[model samples]
Target: MATEATEIEITTIGRRTGEGHSHPVWFIREGKSTFLLPVGGRGSQWFRNLRNNPTIKLGATSAKAKLITDQAKVGQVMDEFSSKYGAADVQRYYPGVDVAVEVRDS
Candidate 1:
């Protein structure tokens, strides 16, 4: 299935342009929800776009995205990412782990 893949494509509407922007991002699927970590934390362009519009498309599936800023909750998600992608890799790629995005199945 798509969820089992290493990465998934997500499309978010541009915060300033109001146009669709797509990017391939690493994700972890837990039950009915998918979690994503911005490589640049909250400074990521896609993440900023999410702040303007929480709606996103995961591959062909449309879903609502929620920004997770709570440190405890973000830590839990980071743990999951570490377990799946390995601790060393997650740290190397995601240096600024200040926030996370949660996308629910739609």
Candidate 2:
């Protein structure tokens, strides 16, 4: 069976140093578009780097430096994220947070 994009966990890169960071982010794919939810908020380096260079290493089994971003389509992806990761407060200090990131699957 082909690997389902939904089943993959993308490993995003850091802003300053291109290091790898893994998080259980929700990914919804349509055509060539993939969406992500950065629950960590401002502390989420993945979101910072992606927004800067839009390049990341998507790692589920292996790794690939693919491009990602955020957009209106995030609402759709956030729905899936809330379903899988649940709508519970992902962060403690900041409640009711719904930050997300949109990326291209590598």
Candidate 3:
């Protein structure tokens, strides 16, 4: 049961370099699913990495990851983020970005 305030480390394989890249990011968990929002949007490097490989490391846990571009689903996930972090904070940190990463059992 990960709280929304919890920051988790995510590692992705670099698309070009083929190296493991790790970064700390905010997460929202619902049941067994975990969601990540890229503050930097689609152009973000980690987002690219996840695109290159759906497999990602969430701290000690390994999960399959996928980019979520559907507007409705993205909005739902954003709502979860907003609910946890507050709308103001989420807007401040994730301005103009609708992209997200969804993690589930690999």
Candidate 4:
């Protein structure tokens, strides 16, 4: 069977409220790692929450997230997203966005 590598359910702890928050979002899986990007970039609520806390749930898996600030890595992830989901879709959903979330095995 093929791997399902498109979207994932991410559960994050709310920074202010201290409650669980879930969001279904597009993801990129490469080997043992996964990556995510906010459609609206760094100003997004989830991103803000993640900044406050890196621990998160990726589907049924517990993972630690690192915000990818390296310009080259961010560009590469963006390219991978464009290739997997198509440029038009990326443009439609994520315009002028460069930040990325790298979710590692925990």
Local accuracy by lDDT, each model? 0.92, 0.52, 0.86, 0.85
Query: Scored by Cα lDDT, where does model 2 land?
Result: 0.52
Better model by TM-score: candidate 2 vs candidate 4: 4
lDDT of 4 by residue, 1-106 (tens): 0245577889999999999899999988777778898887888889889999987898888778899878798888889899899989988999877699998765
Q: By lDDT, highest first, what's the ranking?
A: 1, 3, 4, 2
- Please tell me which model should have the higher lDDT, number 2 or number 4: 4
Q: How many steric clashes between backbone atoms does each model show?
A: 0, 1, 0, 0
Question: Top TM-score: which candidate number?
Answer: 1
- Assess every candidate by TM-score: 0.95, 0.54, 0.91, 0.91
How much does candidate 4 score in TM-score? Answer: 0.91
Candidate number that wins on lDDT, 1 or 3: 1
Clashing pairs in 2: 69-102
Give the per-residue lDDT of model 2 (tens digit) for 1-106. 1325444556666767767666654465556645555555535677666666665545544333333334444455555665655566323323433455544444
lDDT accuracy of residue 38 in candidate 3: 88
Report the Cα RMSD per candidate.
1.0, 4.8, 1.4, 1.7
Better of 1 and 4 by lDDT: 1
Over the full model, what C-alpha lDDT does candidate 1 score relative to the true structure?
0.92
Per-residue lDDT of 46-96 in model 1, one digit per residue for the tens?
A: 999999999899898888899999999899999999999999999999997
Which candidate would rank higher by TM-score, 1 or 2?
Answer: 1
